[model samples]
Target: MDSGQEALTLLLLAPLFFICMVIEYRILKKRGYSDYSLKEVVCNFSLAGLHQAADLIATLLLMPFFLWLYQFRLLDFSLTPVTLIVLFILQDFFYYWFHRASHHIHWLWASHIAHHSSEKMNFTTAFRQSLTYPLSGMWLFWTPLMVIGFPPSAVVLIVALNLGFQFFVHTRIVKKLGWLENIFNTPSHHRVHHARNPEYIDKNFAGVLIIWDKWFGTFVEEKPSLVIDYGIPKQVNSWNPFVTTFHQWRTMLTLALSTKPTPFHIRLRYLFGSPKFADNAEKRGTTIK
Candidate 1:
């Protein structure tokens, strides 16, 4: 995972995204879903850039920790192609559970909700990541890779590649790929995941493969003619990323503390409950089809 290798890996994967985008745009045009205004596209691009910058800064700040892990033999630096592929698959496997937990665990959802806040499903939405994740123990999810002999650098690269693959799946341009859609996490699947519709909420948590969701009972097929309304039901419409990320968290903390005789279970649920739990539990249940 030297700089040259890292750069090359990104370069190689970059074209995949471009190709996917082209395919998506063409499909959207054919389906008459290509009604995006220039202004909206520009806004989405700007937000994506801002998020990328945040991720860059976060990665730099976390570099020392990764380096330290490598220096102490907490991580091994193997670079064979097979090992790298295995690491990539393993990372996505862990990512699946981490993502699933973020939906079920209240505290983690506070940090993860930003990525789901967009009403429009596109590649830009895929870049809309939360800056609060590092503070929320996301790095711990990858520790098993290190413990099992994957190098920290390799793990980081594989993780990045995994994420890069997902960017293409956020768009509405590409529809179902028939069998491919069933076996993989496509835009169709992810759109359902992002939907606030009762049947769509909390489904399709895979990062790369759809098998994880199917095996775990979280899979849901896209229902044709049923439109997806994105964003949390209680929308956090603020453009301020910080507000969007922490507002729910703050409210949840207050609720947890204010509730008298709060059992550990209630506190836990407060952290991970559906976004509308405080307003209407029955509604939240109904919202989740």
Candidate 2:
């Protein structure tokens, strides 16, 4: 499938997404759980709209380059059933690294933090995305697939499928599945992913398969005795879409561009290293928090 087909597929499934959100909202409210608030839901979808718009523009601009790069593919691949299955696994593997890097690298986190900004973990919470993802070089993660002889269209479709599968795992309604939780990324595993607890932070970066996390040693189980607090360590308290999207960008840029007497490498680390390093830099009064 090409970009047009990808968009069409998502458009057709749009109603299903809304239906699931409504069902989750009703169920949470009926159970007297405060997971679904009107304001947060609206903010989630608003950020989603901006994200979609930016993604569409980025896809158009970047698709040509991917197509041009496909000419010198290392291996030729036909879109057979077996190849599609292979593509799915490879795409998930790449997504896992992309997600892990987003957490560790301050540059990417400046965009990804918007998705984790919400304190609520309902179905609509999955809708929260950053419009700056394209700028943050998210599409770079899938370039390997394109260069390995998979059609750019096929890669796009597989990415869409991987992301669609992840949407269902954003809810708190579903408990841990039996053995499937060990293999697939379940709601329980995802809850741990979104949790702010020190043990949970930067864990469970699987997009479809949980095995990557296990093999890579980043997997952490959700503790029944522990309460999960959603949202980042530093919260973006504003509901304004611009503030929610660009707040981290402001912090990161200000820190990286500060005129302090620090070495150039430390300033570079502020832009490209972990948020922990950035926090330390801020604590030294090198930059505003």
Across 186-235, the per-residue lDDT of candidate 2 in tens digits comes to 99999999999888999999999999999999999889999999998888
Tens digits of lDDT, candidate 1, 209-284? 9989999999999999898898887777666656666776776677666535656766666666754564363334
The Cα local distance difference test for each model comes to 0.73, 0.88
Question: What would the TM-scores of all predictions be?
Answer: 0.78, 0.96
**Cα RMSD to the true fold for all candidates:** 4.8, 1.8
> Best-fitting candidate, measured by lDDT?
2
Shift of residue 97 alpha carbon in model 2, Å = 0.4
Error of 2 at 120 (Å): 0.9
In candidate 1, what residue range of length 10 has the lowest lDDT sum? Answer: 280-289
